[model samples]
Target chain A: MRATGDTWPHMAGAAAQPVRRATVATLPAVKMLRRALVALSLAGTIAGLLRMRGKGGVPPQEGGWREVGVPPQ
Target chain B: MTTPIVGLAGCGVTGSRVLHHLAAHQVRVAVYDPSPALARNTRVVRLESAADLMACDLVVLCGPAPHAPLTEMLVADATPVVSVGDDLDDMQALLALQPLAERHGVAAVVGAGMAPGLSGLLARYLAAQLHTLDELHVAVHGTAGPQCARQHHAALGDAALGWHDGEWIQPPGGSGRDLVWFPEPIGAHDCYRAALPDPLLLQRGFPTAQRISARVSATRRDRLTARLPMLTPPHAAGDLGSVRVEARGAGPHGERVSVIAGVAGPTAELAAVVCAATVGQLLRHPVAPGVHALGDEALAGLDLLHHATQLGVRVQEFTGVARATSW
Candidate 1:
């Protein structure tokens, strides 16, 4: 993961632990607030995906998820 | 130095065009899809899963949207995502990451396809000229198949919401509109609000717009208008899709000036050009922080206008900004 210098608003309570915030903004958040954002992002994604799945929308890793750059000859 | 690698999901029409463009530019390109037969490109990669996208410097999602969740996982540090299809989970996820992307210098361009992508682009263009912009109207109607949702998908359950009338208004109930859009190749295609004024992205990307909408164009007027309430999430339609958008504003002397952008063709080419235009523009300039439209900063110049014109997108400027002028 690339280090986002300061573009993101780091979560609400993340200003205090500047070291932790600096150390881990990637998946395995070093700070708790960063971890919380990741968790929420993940949870929202799951809920969004599940909602679409109900409508027969494409599920992650399904056949539609199949990569096809070329059409059949 | 090696070329930047880009992984494209769903190599259908728009995806393929993007792949071809990237390949032509000598950008190493890989793809993730279940299907075997694909388009002819320089570095066509066969992937076992979407995770393959993680390998590239940039990832352009061209398939259905439920793939949003994958973004948090697939998009690692530094790698920004550009979503091209009906699904906007990628855009939402990107928005969630906006502060990071801006602060850390990571680049994530959302809705980088035709409608949402170019719609965002148009937002940039209109917002630039306005003195005190309040409202912007956008429309779209150009795709040739059912954009229906894949079966059993649940992420699509959310309704279509656009920033409008001050805040994001997810209008309830479906109601068709009697709109006449001037599309390319064919003139004056019928269109209605498939979703609400889709220009909602403007709120985050372009600060000037009070509202903007890019809706679906139909063959006949009011034929496909859905009740705002009935209008659910943007499900796939069974037939081809066509789109047109007009950016309207109140001129200084109580006059309205508008810019009309019309693109007609299969989804991929348009998506590719728009995405390419978005990337091409972004690469050339340093985009300011705060969410932005495709045309936000990079896409306003003559290059995009020429490229779009070369590809058959018509962008016209009118004297008055009036919804009444639209069909």
Candidate 2:
């Protein structure tokens, strides 16, 4: 599945987890935790929108516009 | 008491919403999505594959119809798959996993999204109201913003097919009867015809409904409506919007009932709401073993929404907590 692309401004490249696309995952437990939380949080934030994400079975609803009360991604 | 952990196959819109709901109640989740960006918030893990099953009590398969193999792989010895996509093909795939699920003491609940999700609850709800329900008609109106639609437009193309009458009927996209919904912002809007009454699972779940049809009168292209389930070029692109389900039922003495429930947000946010409630119900209830559907006693319809409402999700229903009185 295609991960979130450079949709939102300033989101294209941030050096928190070194998002290596195309390459399969190779993170240890600690980094995986951080990556896992951030990624899942982002997923929660963009649930509805990503439901229809590109055809790659990626996040169907990715990026922006979260539910009113739910936390931001 | 903490709800048992849930395993999410897809962390897209619907999956995220399920996570959001669980998080509100301090529910921990173990998810396996290819997208690292999406699993950043919850108790997500980097699992090898669906066969791993993580350590979750209930497993929910979200997003559009993912590869059948991916779905089956997730149904390991002890995890039940609460599917968001349902069809004959889906049923067949799920049935293949029954032995595995049963072996692990897990039961699969198929078709657990908004249409199947809420509509299933309505079918059970209305069936309990009368000696017997005659018919159930569901009309959906979805309008997503342009930006959100641009990225994941293929979903609008999925045709919703369900049980109707004493037989199976594939009504054209715009072929179902027109309907009117009493929603929050969009008031009294017309609803187009869908494949059938509730999601595919309603056929078995609803007690005695003679016919059921699910329709959509989305603000999207009318021509693309019927082609929703077909292979063709889309008529338009990118526009996120809200979706509402209007259910019209006929009971004894011709008792007529119409109820509408839906989510309003940027497409992604709404998708999260759908997901949150789904996974939450899977863990909180007495999830039975074997192949289950959305309308099963586990995810108790509006009762799920009631849980969602307590956690601050936005839902609008005719009666129950979502009654117009609060609106």
Candidate 3:
């Protein structure tokens, strides 16, 4: 795909680098937090499914756009 | 020059909204859709065949993905084309026709829909405010129609593509989760990397950027069940959708700066306004012949945003609260 010079910009002299994979130990706290979130989400999904029994799907919500500030010039 | 008649090829959820926007602008449109019930409005002139759309000055294809063949046909016939296809593979194919479009002297705008469309425009708008742009990160929130919902489902399971320091990276989809905050009503959501075409289209425009990545908002269940068929049928039309574009670069003084801008509304409505605005721009000032994304420097991002605003799409930028001088 890189050979197709027309599609992508020529990478003058930059050499591609290998992606590094981090071990679980490198971010154990983050991993634990993610696991906790997933568990909570799973529980919530089960509860929602139970609530959905014999109910038509939730109605789509309505919304309106509100501009906070102007885009940078 | 006289007002150019626009051709519409699809009248699905997004295409039908595109028709409404165009009609609101008082633009004459020639429509051709396989489903007879899709385009029954009196304003648009219905055509019997898709090929007849070539007679119009320009054609806006809001059809399903893989619009490359029809786009090629229109360009070959010297009719400018604009496509709102969001599929990654299909966008790549449409973009590959750059040489053909240039040779035919007919412009072809690819990915003129919400994320790749409005997202690219916002990226360019923010890039213009910086001294040197280094990174661009995009997160999309919702889907428009059933077709869009299905595409979203597939994208979550496909290989994700990203641009990093001039090299392409393919990572497993449904990974790399990040929390993104959109505008009001659609606050924060968990976004994950997916097979989005934003990186591809944005890379074409901002080739020098060091990193470019895109993600779609999804739930934990969405990621877990990505590889399998959808357990539940997707909504016929999704609720409010939003896209957040974050750009990191240097300020005018060489200081680090980050700009985040977004737009939230009905995805189909946003896509429709964007398509109509691009068509309006094309009619007034035709771009050079070739495949162009919305944010390409050649196209005026600010002007396009202004046009979209006129068509009822609101753009919002995040501004951090000012620090107190003394507390």
Candidate 4:
């Protein structure tokens, strides 16, 4: 897919460089942190799903914009 | 829930990302581009002519500037349309699309991505939270490695137009400097006034705003390249983009009020998410038949804040802060 150009200035003629894949060995500390974050997120999602199992899911909004506080001072 | 037919006109980087977004939602999308290979995704129908795409419930023009011709044609067909990026930066050019949309009984949303789209919405939303609105300042910081040098030069070196005290003023790009603070990951940076569409779109939505300015800043190297043509664009910094919109007005208690909403992430992806959310609203037919800015009441008929939140775009609102002392 072509990137949207025309809307803003195009980045032309800049030197192209290949991106190196991040590896655990290259950045062990950062890799460990990312793994922990993913594990925590997955646990949270599973817990939330379990909690909502009997509640017929969260209730639908009574009014759309009302929940968002749309434009009206 | 039934999906509305969506037609995307361009397959550039931004358009490509937008296509992925719509597909993730399982919306039926047909894309038209000069090179059909651009829309070579297995999910969407790739059409060759405008004739096929015009019949869609909503059309997104991600094509190049000189949007007047195609945009006007869509309005004539009574098709609601939206454009991402800077094609409508010129007020006269965007205003030209309004009457056609009104006469055709279709809604046309201009500047519905990233800065112009999300920033405009934040401005109007903040105005709604105030008793009397006075001014608005929108600042965007994009930290890309040196690969975006040309974009930086165009953004910062070109002439800048800002709205001040009910008048539009042109200032040399990168001329006016202001130290602005943003959300974490993209802390305070020295921003300079640049000709961006957010302030203009905001002024249209909130005419009472006395001062409207849009400034853009980036990493120190990119900022330097934007100012000097001789310098080569620097290599990529860590990809982190942020935008902050500040609105100042009076609150119900007659105290000075400031409301700031900010989002930080990959700039192109953020624009696509915003564009997709806008398409989601248009599919629901909440927008009335006419032309409207993304933040205007007519367009806000759709739950923009809600749609944005659903896309995982973190939006933070700060209230009761004094503008002068805070930033």
* Candidate No. with top lDDT: 3
Model 4, docking class? incorrect
Best by TM-score: 3
> Model 2, B1-327: lDDT tens per residue?
555777777766556666666667777677777766654654455455766554667676664454356555655545556676533344556656656767767666665554555556545544555555566665544422232232123333444465656877665455444534434554445455543325456666664666766665555454454344434343232123445544455556676655445555444444455556656655556565576665655445336555545544465555532122111
Model 4 lDDT tens row, B1-327:
455788999876667778988988888888998865665566668887988878788889776565667778888988888877553244457667777777888887888777778888778667877899998999987733232334545668667878898899988888778876666667778889766777778878888889999988855665566666636544333256777888888998888887777777777667778899998877776577666778787776677766876786777654333334221
RMSD of 1: 28.0
TM-score of each: 0.63, 0.61, 0.79, 0.73
Instruction: Write model 3 residue lDDT over A1-73, tens digit each, in one string.
Output: 4665355544432335455676556478888999999999999999889887646554323332347533333
Task: Give one digit per residue, the lDDT tens place, for model 1 in B22-124.
Answer: 6666666778877555634435676678776777776777766555565545444556666664554445655676566566555566666666666665455
Model 3 clash pairs are: none
Q: What is the fnat value (0 to 1) for candidate 2?
A: 0.05
What lDDT score goes with residue B27 in model 4? 85
Task: Let me know the TM-score candidate 1 reaches against the reference structure.
Answer: 0.63
lDDT of 3 at B145: 82
How would you order the candidates by TM-score, starting with the best? 3, 4, 1, 2
- Model 3 lDDT, full chain set: 0.86
* Top candidate when judged by DockQ against the true structure: 3
